[model samples]
Target: MPDYKKNSISLTGAVGLGTGVMISAGIFALLGQVAELSGSWFPLIFIIGSIVTAFSAYSYVKMSQEYPSAGGIGMFLVKAYGKGTITASAALMMAVSMIINQSLVARTFGTYTLQLFDGAQTEWLVPLLGVGLIVVSFLINISGNTFIQTFTSIASLIKIIGLSTMAIAGIIVADFAFTIPNKASNPPDIGIVSSVAAIALTILAFKGFTTITNSGEEITKPKKNVGRAITISILVSLSVYLLLAWAVSSNLTLSEIIAAKDYALAEAARPAFGDFGVWFTVILAIIATITGIIASVFAVSRMLAMLTEMKLIPHKHFHMPGSIQKHTLVYTVVLAIVLTVSFDLTRIASIGAILYLVMDIMIHWGVFRHLRKKVNANPFIVVSAIVLDLIVLSAFLWVKFQSDIVVVVVAILMITFIFIGEYAFLRKTSD
Candidate 1:
């Protein structure tokens, strides 16, 4: 019996925003990395991961119905398990993780936007523009939910138009067989490592469903709609990922994809429609990034508010003064700091990915165990999901361990805050 509005998101709005939110992170970015990691098995890994994520969608959908609140992972953890402090702290981490993930993706969108500007330093200019976007989005968010929702709907449409155009052109023009690894890797050396690394990065593409859970409170029909939203949105996004992988992999040699990879959407489109391809993708990336920034900052701030509700954080530092409009600025400002400081999508994405997977595992096991008490389900399915989640997580860690110091530090800093918040503050509050 929450006092919140019951007019949940329509299936249409949910699916559209879900798709808009996911496409930018997954397709515009992750393909090249996955291509490198999966080696000959790139397509296989994605197909497999998509299946799990699809189920992951179902699992969370169930959790959403059981605990219908805006808290998302926090609600799932605290309500189901009655471990308020732990989940409250976890909610804080989820908030930061969303900021990192969203800002990184938005900045990448910035990178693509700079391509549209002549005489612009694509590298630095992209991040600077991303900073500007974060600022603008903050103002929009603090304005009100009506503004955020309306704006996101428009952003989603822009994304659909841009991505749909690419997908259509690719299917008609590109050949999948060309990119499919014809021969199995006889003995892929350190290349195997790269493929695994790619899985971690690419997982970010499939990472948007959880955000729907963040807005669970707003959903018109929590049980029915939220589940459908999470599942359908992910399935929709994953289908495109498969299409893009085939489209990009099918048409271009791995080396060529790598060479023209950042602009892979444009590169893929070139064969189908030369010169027009560049503008087409540039337009899509811009639309996708703008919406992603809006959707993400709004969602993350709501998640932080959940922490306050449970007394995990003092309500004052993070309070929603009116209908979520109050905290959007705070979330946007944090996003600005991350984007302006760096366009290290890889590191920020990595840390975000790790937190997401860890949260997924916690919720996955938490819910499955709860169900086991009442009814029987396959241990194998649960075990397999767990194993695959680890494999995905391990692949990420393996690559992350070797490459960057900063990625490790940022992840550690975020994690350290979670632990301290849980043991020190959450514990004291409970006592």
Candidate 2:
């Protein structure tokens, strides 16, 4: 085996990694859907989502500070649950959800790209493009961590500058773009349940911060940089989200937004900066999705490598001579391809959001019950995280149950199967 060199990712590089993993096409596509729920108050709803995510981040930050490892959340679960059925099951759920999320962003990449052309809405094109990007990401990842870090940093820079320009330009043009008061045009009577439901999707937008934790070992100053990277990334994401949401809501009326819900930002760009804005926004969406997929594949493959080392999951050599991370990268891309081809965008996002929230709840509960005192983490924050997750998850389920019952059922089935399979595997290994 060739000795692998240690990755020397700096704090800024770690922050870039986190941002690139997050700032994906989810925000590009879901703004209109969130607007439908929160109406004119989508900006405030984004902030609410950030606050809730912060509560959950508290547990992760505290635990990661005490126990910084490349094992990421899996290590946290083992420490809290003691390597039993519960730890294995929760880790599996989180991993699967992340895999599902890759498919979501992959399809989003295809969706946003097709927006550039007329009659581009073919059923096969989306999955084809998604799988193609996954293959590209796999090749880059196997090249090594240094290459991945350098590529993501550049992608992250372009993404930030593009989005910031769009947001600022939109805000500046909102004054002359439409003289009518947006509030008078549409008054949203969104109740508490609807607001909570909107935050569920918003939470998905911030889920990329968890990707940073997976890179804990690679980051310089693992103890301090890990938490700092997560915090800084979330703040940056929140700022960009709020600014863009305000821009969209300000320039576009409720009807216009809902009409172009599939590609809201691109549509909003048209009115703000005309044809150029449309092209710019679409290009940004493409970049965001591309980098997002690359960063995500990097994190999830590393996570699976960790899982294999712990013997929580089965692995195969496949006659390939490479390190554990290389093999896991192949497996990760293959699974993502399967998911991309099988599910549509809405169903994929539904499964990813539900599974992730469920796993997050388990993480918070584990800490609250077992590791809180040991880690010196605040009990109130842990409890608040649990409560917030439960409320948002319930609201999201209710929304999906009413609109897309099939997706919700599939999510439940997926969760059940993961738990049962992990338990059986662990039992067999013990015997």
Q: Per-residue lDDT of 1-431 in model 1, one digit per residue for the tens?
A: 24234564556666655776687756776665566555655766677667767656656676677676776777777754665655665666667666876777666776676656557364666667767877777777666555666777777766766676577567667542444634442224436656656666656777777778877888778777888888787777777777667766666666666555455666766677776776877888877777776777767777766656566665443534554325544754775566556646555677778877776676667667665333244446656666667887777776777776666667777787777767787667767
lDDT of residue 303 for candidate 1: 71
In the range 144-245, model 2's lDDT, one tens digit per residue, is 777877888888889888898889889888762433325554535556677788898888888888888877777788889889999999998888887788
- The models' CA-based lDDT, in order, is 0.67, 0.83
Q: Show how many residue pairs clash in every candidate, following the order shown.
A: 6, 0
Deviation from truth (RMSD, Å), model 2? 2.3
- Model 2, position 313: C-alpha lDDT score: 76
Clashing pairs in 2: none
Residue 310's lDDT in candidate 2: 83
Query: How high is each candidate's TM-score?
Result: 0.87, 0.94
Which segments of model 1 are wrong by more than 4 Å?
1-4, 83-85, 118-122, 175-178, 181-193, 315-325, 370-380, 428-431
